[model samples]
Target: MSAITLGAVRPRFRPRRISPARWGLYAFILITALYFLLPLYVMIVTSLKPMAEIRQGHLLALPASPSLAAWVKAWTSACTGLTCEGIRTGFFNSLRILLPSVVISIVVGSLTGYALSLWRVRGANILFGAMMIVAFIPYQVFIYPLVRVFSFTGLGQSLATIVTIHTIFGLPTMTLLFRNYFASLPVELFKAARIDGAGFYQIYARIMMPMATPMIVVAVILQTTGIWNDFILGLVFAGRDNLPMTVQLNNIVNSTQGERAYNVDMAATLLTALLPLVIYFGSGRWFVRGIAAGAVKG
Candidate 1:
């Protein structure tokens, strides 16, 4: 009986050999990670080094004496244009544009998606088709016409114009995202809400919106990244005062009048990218969960 009981308890640990194929896959993954990480590593190291040390030509070496002066200068006094006021101005402008554009685009897109998905609106199919087409068309095609219309209406090159431009461009994709998500939801939920005397807006506001938290997160991430990184649109529509961080970074990097401050340029580029990076990494799990939760299903 003792021997039988001992045999019934299986061994807790076993050594398993990795196959050659598995080893090759691991090597490939490591190589891929290094390929992407090398540039970022160089950027970080370079940003910490002084110009004298950087000029010594050790591109991949750690800085002999690391400092934040470059970062400070990049944030406070790096010449972006005729002004030496740094990228902080553009940072603030980006924030202003990002918040309003994200909120308005997500709200309007989600509502339009909800209406088309559940409600029996006339010409819904045609509207959806047209929007999908617009989504695929290059936005460059509409730039001239949109400029003409906005200028004709006396709304050219301002915060409002930029926000409106972001919202309009974002609508088709936003609507598609929310519409697919809404369509994937159980039909019984909508049916039950209607049976319980919930009006269209009531059902949408209380039930639908509450259940759309995941999609909303996805939309926020996408819009925040897109609007913050927008250079062309900002250059064309954001006016001089409302130029975004990307535009400022371009100016900092491309200022040909003086010797290129590589360290400052690296720091400014990282600064311009930091917000999107933070948002993406902080909410990466939620982004995956949102995508998995029927973001593409229809």
Candidate 2:
């Protein structure tokens, strides 16, 4: 007969329960969130209120007589200078500048980053250093020189010139972002692609780009916000016929000759903010992953 020994089972580990410190941390985070959200709340409430109620100085209070008249005026009838065409023209003009600028900037930046990360080229480090230095310089410093160059080229203040300016300004950061992201990827893949006799563009098109979706989302978010909120560049390079919504909104709110309409100003601001807000909200998971992945090895 064989004797069998029974073995005692070990207990599974359990996570510790939340302590008072943890609860305090949660409370702090919630309070900070609310603090930041208060201004947005005020803006929304003010935009909804009529001018009559606005004059009463109740900023945080809900509107007693809420109406969309201000919104309507901002979108269709607000005067900027001699034009009463609202912000529609500016909106279209922004699109014209934004679309081409975003596309060209991203494409150029991605390619530049890719080459710097993967390919060996002479003076690459020096070129990249120059770009980084340019990135830190104040944008205003370049305005006069860029204006002169544009004027000399006969481009002056056209859509093309503005697009070029955006592309130039956007390059360094965008290149750095993609470069860091690509550097984080496995070198084995590039080697394997090269072993198969794949050219630079072939490898980029087939492998590198497909793996860069997250970084692309991040780049889009950054560029979209910067370009959309840019007042000075648009004012200088976009000309009168190509003024963006920011310029139009500024003109409407800051005109020295007219009585300020608080409700309309707020409404226009909210509207102007809508697109970037939409982009940020819609970016969702990709934005987080992109930043995480890019920063991991940078």
Candidate 3:
């Protein structure tokens, strides 16, 4: 009989089975997703339902007869004041404010963040701490003071004034974002640039800015959302001619007289919200990465 020698046998690879904990996690995620999506579902279906069907009081049910009339009315013929010109005017006005405000705020914030992170200037810490404290204070508290200051400067209730207001309010948060992101970078890079005789602007323009693509996207998303959806600030600062879509949306929905067109109201609300939703979704990947990078060190 041949002697059978015990030899090493490699274990076959087997796929791991899902644990109960993982299944529970999946269930929890599905529940949370449904919760968040509930409102959006309601808004969409409500917008599609006609005034007749809506009057039947079947809110949760799918529209028996879907119609695009509400969307058409909200976009082209909704009355806000004597003008029946829909939300188009306000849309253009918002774009004018949004473009300039986003550009100026991001530029100023990036510079401020860069200085605070890289330079050890006198009173920098005190200034940054003061800014942080200001951020915690409600924006409503600044309205009166800001109005007074704007009136004193003769910039009251105009495009420029609104843009300035957005910039001012956006600064602290933006600075903190970029500052933390910069702080997470390698110190060696700065030292190497310094060894090459690069000054502040040179180092920033060539090195820092180039490496800050993700954070810039993040800043854009934040400023766009806040500045776009701002009803109070726009109403206060964006003069009559410059009223944003949100203000127009409010006028359409909050009328005290005449039959309330719920369908049109919902459509207008969704349309006003579409811009921010687009920005959020478009920059979703960058937003996550930027936030992660910013939060890494500080």
Candidate 4:
């Protein structure tokens, strides 16, 4: 009997040969990955090389002497404009904008989504429809109107203004994300909470929010990256004192007053992009789980 069991398992565990189609698929995936990663590899190597080595124009070669000097200069003393101060100022400014915007947007969106999904509020469908439409509309079309409104409200181009702008723009997508996620949850849970003495806020704070951890991580990642990488909105809304890292990097890269510092430019670009990349990669699993949990469902 043991020999027969072993024979059965051995047949089941037989090594599968790769078909030509499978090989082609693997080759496609490898080529696609390299296509995307090659630019990043070049950027990293270029950032490590000094200007002297960069002048040799060997774009694909590894640095002979990799150094962090360019990274340090890009962070601390690379001239963004008239000032010699580096992108650190914008980095702090981005943090200030990112934290509040992420928190407020997620909180409000979750609340809105929870209410819309679970409650019997009037015109919820219409409101959601309007929001969906607004989401599809290019935000640039509203930029002028928003600027006018902020100016009229005396919130002109300040940290507060930028934060408010991010929250407002983020609401549609965030609400959609949470609303879909919430809608996908078991209705029995909501019914059970209702059967208990639990109230609206109580259900959300105690049960829904906790259960929505994956979605929350997804929201945080989305908001952090979107708000961090935003350039036009930051340029238009954030006051001169609150330019984001992207703006600073742009200033550094585009300044043609002197010889271009390719190493510094690459480093600055990477620095500006690092936060989003880190957040996305670190929480990629959660992001995928959230989407699977019902980010796409009605």
Give TM per candidate: 0.89, 0.86, 0.85, 0.88
Q: What tens digits encode model 1's per-residue C-alpha lDDT throughout 24-123?
A: 9899999999999998898899999999989986999999889999999899999965798888988999999999999999989999999999988999
lDDT score, candidate 3: 0.84
RMSD of 2: 9.3
For model 4, how does the per-residue alpha-carbon lDDT over 130-184 read when each residue is reduced to its tens digit?
Answer: 8877876877799999999999999999999999999998888788888877998
Model 4 spans with C-alpha error above 4 angstroms: 1-15, 18-26, 289-298
Span of ten consecutive residues with least summed lDDT in model 3: 1-10
From the highest TM-score down, the ranking of the candidates is 1, 4, 2, 3
- Taking the tens digit of each residue's C-alpha lDDT, what string does model 3 give over 1-298? 0111112244787448888887898899999999999888888899999998889868788988788899889889888867888887888999999999999999899999999998888998898888887887877888988899998999888999999999998888789888877888998999899999999999999999999987788788778887899999999988999999999889877862678888888888899999988876887666455444333323
Best by TM-score: 1
- TM-score head-to-head 1 vs 3, winner: 1
- Local error of candidate 1 at 218, Å? 1.2
Residue 224's lDDT in candidate 1: 83
Q: Candidate 4 deviates by what RMSD? A: 7.0
CA lDDT, every model vs. true structure: 0.86, 0.83, 0.84, 0.86
lDDT of 2 at 243: 91
What's every prediction's RMSD, in angstroms?
Answer: 8.1, 9.3, 9.8, 7.0
